[model samples]
Target: MESNQEVQISTNAIISFTDSYTQNKQRKEKELLEFESKSARAIISFTDSYAQNKQRKQNEQQESESTLSLAQVTSRLESLSNQIQYNNGCKLVIQIPKLLQSLIALVTFRIGTHLKQEIDLQRIEVRRQSRWCLSSIQVYGDEQIQSELVRQGYGRVMSITLSKAGGIDEEQDEEIYNGLRSISRFLRGLHAGRNNDYQPSFQPLPLLARRSIEQLEEEGANEEIEAQMNNRYNGLIKVWANDAKDMILNCFIYRRRR
Candidate 1:
């Protein structure tokens, strides 16, 4: 997705200063409104056939596959629970990642698209580890990421208008080279704002720049480069999802006193 290089913009702090300061708290409430990814298909698919066959051998067990959602049940848990609770009542909580990703994908897709034409976002995703965690809405998407940087950049211009509704502007940045300029500028601007200043321990790297780094690591690259690359890679991944988790917890803390 091309960046919205020329979208008119502004840094109006009208997003409720109270809420902005309470970014953590707002983050929590926002979090509660969302749930985690269920399970992954790659994992689920592998377990499905294995699970059914295993169940057949344990004919003494009486668990029905229909009872659980694909995203909520795991092969091991299902087996153990069925075995332990044979002819008895039991509670099983099997979590999967695929379902969660699907949910995040759906929500993100909707949000990004709904807000798209305005800034021209193509897609959205749940944060990096939302599938692993139970509640997080850190949105992710290549196009949306680009869109965010682009929109945030163009939105700052006084000549441009921030009130523009969903309508694609003719101008868009071509690639990461053009896009990061806006993102870097936007982030720097965010640092200027007092509210978003509580910088986290981790820093993020754009997805566009990760593949080569990862590829090099797999090839057993040099220590200095690998360490740096891994640190940056993991940092970005954490910032996307784990940072949100911390933010949500802190939000809860601040909320109690308020």
Candidate 2:
């Protein structure tokens, strides 16, 4: 009986040792699995951060390049605009009738006086044929002077003809003749004083003989008739000259190549 008991006790002790070993193996495997999961999560997080940083750098580089390109384009446009504005290739043809030489001289004088610059008469080409005159001139001075002339109704650009090479096209002989015809017609109408016909009738002052007692007493009979005539004539001359100046300046001048 003692021998049988000893064998059973040894068998029980072996079974308990096997169970402890199994439990330890299972616990180690669980810990290993958790470690692997944490490593995988860390790797994924690192990769995502790297990708975001690279993308942000690329976007910044593209924005910088775009800004540089826009600046270059703007600078080029301003340079081109300045070049075009001051270009000297442009010319003008002004037509005036032979009968209005004095008017043309007056207009030229006024232009010089107002602009504070002498008229370059050598640059002007005068062609007198039959009954009319043609004055061809080159466009000079800065944009300010050109703009001022336009504002004052001195220059009317009838047409702009471009050259084959993108410069000003030379003026044609036919254009000069056409301009003369137009000017002649305008001058004819103006000289006839058709616009004066539309003016309101002038109200004459009451004669001294027909004046009221109070008026006669206030204004003496010895009032100088010559002085009154002179004043009236001067006023009329001023008004008429201004009207004529505007009419002449407002005429169309053809722009063409030199």
Candidate 3:
């Protein structure tokens, strides 16, 4: 009987030990799973943070570079402004020859490899820019500078540019009108209040004005194209005609004053 009781006790102890070992193994597995999940989460969070930081740094660097570029541009503009204000545009005076050459090329539209219409548009822009440049020179320059331009044959060159209409294609009607407008502006800039004797011996502004008006009248009366007739380019031509009239009157008044 004692042997049988000892056998039963050994079997119960073995079963309890096995149950306890199984519970411990399950708990260790749960802990290991939780640790692995936390590690994965930590890696994900670190990667996301690193990416955000890298992008932020790149954006900041770009912003900083943009700011530096803007600052440099501002500094240069301020320096140029100071130079222009203090020295009466001495720098501009020194660059007159180069400026004239560039303006001449632009006004003539002789340096492009674009479509015909696009080139014509560019020519219009360049002509307008040239007029503005000349106007600026007239406004900023004194009599001495004006005389220097005259001595440099600026008057002769401008007159010829106007007379030739900058070599614009005649088929480009709009460009023709624009050329006339710009030519009137060029003439005004060249000799608004200047002495007649000081002006280049080119065709007189009054005579040129008459010729331009007559040409416009002829075109309006004689053009057979339906598009040309409906365009009323002659009406628009009056804008340049009026400008020429003003130039003529100014020339007469200036001559009388002299």
Candidate 4:
């Protein structure tokens, strides 16, 4: 009887150990599966987020590109012109050489010899707006700003433009007049500024203007054109010079009084 009881106790102990081992194995397997599932979910979430971000960037790029239409450019130009009417705006734009070059390029841009009538008209309008902006800069800007513009080939461009002949319509005439006046005004400010106004690298406006006049004459500008150059253009230049001088003198006196 004692032997049987001992055997029964041993059997019970072995069964309990087996049951505990099986439960531990099952728990480990369940934990491994949960870990693998979580890793897969994390990778999938990352991929989706990456795809969404890429799509958003592409949409933004398309939207930005679409806004660069001709109408948008013209509207922006007009807005810029209006802003430049203020002193701060004029100063801000003048500091950026690239922006200045872009503005000048717009003035000189030509699509082709044969553009559609509508396209040509749009081009003309854009050019006109650009010219207006430049003119405003020359008018509102100081001598240093004017000198910078001239240094960037504004004077040279105007010289070439004014010297063009054979198509003098009302609009062309107006353009020429404005171009000439713009040069004259800038030259006036530059002269009044003297050594105090210009950078060391800049050439004098008077020298450039004289050379331009000579070039126009050599290009076969008629006597009528010559007279317009001599009287109307040069005469305005003199008037502007005097105006600039008086302005300087007044500023000087005012500072002295202060």
Best TM-score goes to which candidate? 4
Superposed model 2: Cα runs more than 4 Å off: 43-258
lDDT for each residue of candidate 3 in 1-258, tens digit (9 for 90 to 100): 443343234333323332343454465467557656765779857666556655664554345334324233223323333343444553353353344443333343332323366544544554444444444454455455454544444444444444444325553454445544554554464454344443323322343333433443343422222222244547665566566546534555543453
RMSD of 2: 43.1
For every candidate structure, what is the RMSD over all alpha carbons to the true structure, in angstroms?
Answer: 23.0, 43.1, 35.1, 31.1
Per-candidate TM-score against the hidden true structure: 0.16, 0.17, 0.36, 0.50
Clashes of each: 17, 1, 0, 0
Better of 1 and 3 by lDDT: 3
- After superposition, candidate 3 runs with Cα above 4 Å error: 1-97, 111-120, 123-128, 152-236, 245-253
CA lDDT of 148 in candidate 2? 31
Worst 10 residues of 4 by lDDT: 10-19
Give the poorly placed runs of model 4, Cα more than 4 Å off. Answer: 1-67, 164-168, 193-258
lDDT of 4 by residue, 94-168 (tens): 664456666666664342322356655555655666677777776677657665666667755555555541122
Better of 1 and 3 by TM-score: 3
Give all candidates' CA lDDT scores: 0.25, 0.28, 0.43, 0.51
- In model 4, how many backbone clashes occur? 0
**TM-score between candidate 2 and the true structure:** 0.17
List model 1 lDDT by residue over 97-201, tens digit each.
232223222222222234324223322111111121111111112223323323322212211111111223222211211222222333332222213322222
Q: Identify the runs in model 1 with alpha carbons over 4 angstroms from their true place.
A: 1-233
